[model samples]
Target: MNTFAHIKPIAQYNKVSYYSVCIEGNEISLFEEFITHHTSTNKKKLNHVLDWIKLIGNKYGAQSHLFRPEGETADASALPPKGIERKPHYTEYGKKKANNIRLYCLRANENVVFLFNGDIKTAHYAQDCPNVRKHFKLANKLTKAIDSAFANKDIVWNDDCTEIDCEDDFKLQF
Candidate 1:
């Protein structure tokens, strides 16, 4: 079955531009849905992931070292790798120990990234985790489709390669 989706920019910073996928007929993007779903059950992990996203977008510039490869067939990755610990100084929340939340994405380049959906990984591997299995599969599929789009010139890079240039109505099928 063919699934249709579109890319929309959710956030833009001086260093990187973050885009998210919105499936056909869906009001919220996959990334947004991930945030909403985890807000109640995984607030700390969610905040940690969000903080990294902001840092990557505003300061770090989507560095490859910040993401963990998750794609089986494409160049997709997941954020907040396992065993990463950070102390959240912004809130009264204590140190961020081990975060199981995995937000899959495509690190298009130093300046571009595509944020996708994810869930709390209950098992050691995403394939073995019931919570993240579907999301992992969907993210890989979309990543492959987006990769093809780039190869076919459907998605082009800006002159400086700091951003992507695509039609507003451009739709991707996966």
Candidate 2:
């Protein structure tokens, strides 16, 4: 069976255009599902991750240093990077912390990011973690499909490489 996902625009910030995927037949986008699932159980961590996303989208852009590489392939990454700490009186500061919550995504460029779904990773490796195994695999598959779309000119970067241009009904199959 083939799985399909459509690129759904989430937010357009000054530095980047944030996006998420809506899989065929699903009511909510993957990123929305991720937020809903973790909202109650991991509120604080979720906030931290959101803060990071806001900072990237509004101020910093999707810089390479912000994402934690996730997949074996080069495309997938996660948010709320390791070693980041939440200080009481300062902006997001740095300190070692084991963040189990993973939100897999693709940092398309400094100006575009595609948010995917993820879960609490219980193991060191995504494939070994029961909770995040499917998410990780799905992220990788979607990443590859999106990459191919770009390669085939189905998805083209806008001028300045800050955004992408594609048909409104463009869908990726994996």
Candidate 3:
């Protein structure tokens, strides 16, 4: 179990991406606690990310899909190319090219928390982001404290339609 899974740090804003991190204990409801606690100061940052995720989840969950475990096959049906099945795809208006987006969901005691809305091209190195990596280390330490509690769990797809609105102010470091 990678301790990184426990780290659920809320996202900081940028022109292009939305991100969050967490490194809490793997107790039954720890995942829920992390998201509930670390909301972006600015609601927009929060809502934007949440809405983007909901947008795609709603798109796919409305259909028959497969949820593949992380360590097994990267069976991402929603994204383009489809995990090594990379190819050029076209959208309805030809406005957006079909690039693969990897929205991987992590499961913690059935909550299936940690919503990432990045594409395959970007996701390839998401786990290595400097900000994310810092919390990743923190989550690692937390997992060590908990005797590495993530040994047993299954990844699942979540489409609960989470709604987050933009905030007046948002802060990244606390």
TM agreement with the true structure for every prediction: 0.90, 0.89, 0.28
Question: Total backbone clashes of model 3?
Answer: 23
Report the Cα lDDT for candidate 2.
0.84
In candidate 2, clashing pairs total: 0
**CA lDDT of every candidate:** 0.85, 0.84, 0.32
Best by TM-score: 1
lDDT of 3 at 14: 25
Model 1, residue pairs in steric clash: none
Greater TM-score among 1 and 3 belongs to 1
Give the per-residue lDDT of model 1 (tens digit) for 55-172: 8888879888888776455457898754444423323345435677899998999999999999988987788899999999888889899999999999999998888888889999
Tens digit per residue, CA lDDT, model 3, 45-91: 33433454444344433222322232223221222223222222233
lDDT of 2 at 62: 92
Residue 11 in model 1: shift from native, Å? 0.2
Winner on TM-score between 2 and 3 is: 2
Which numbered prediction scores highest in lDDT against the true structure? 1
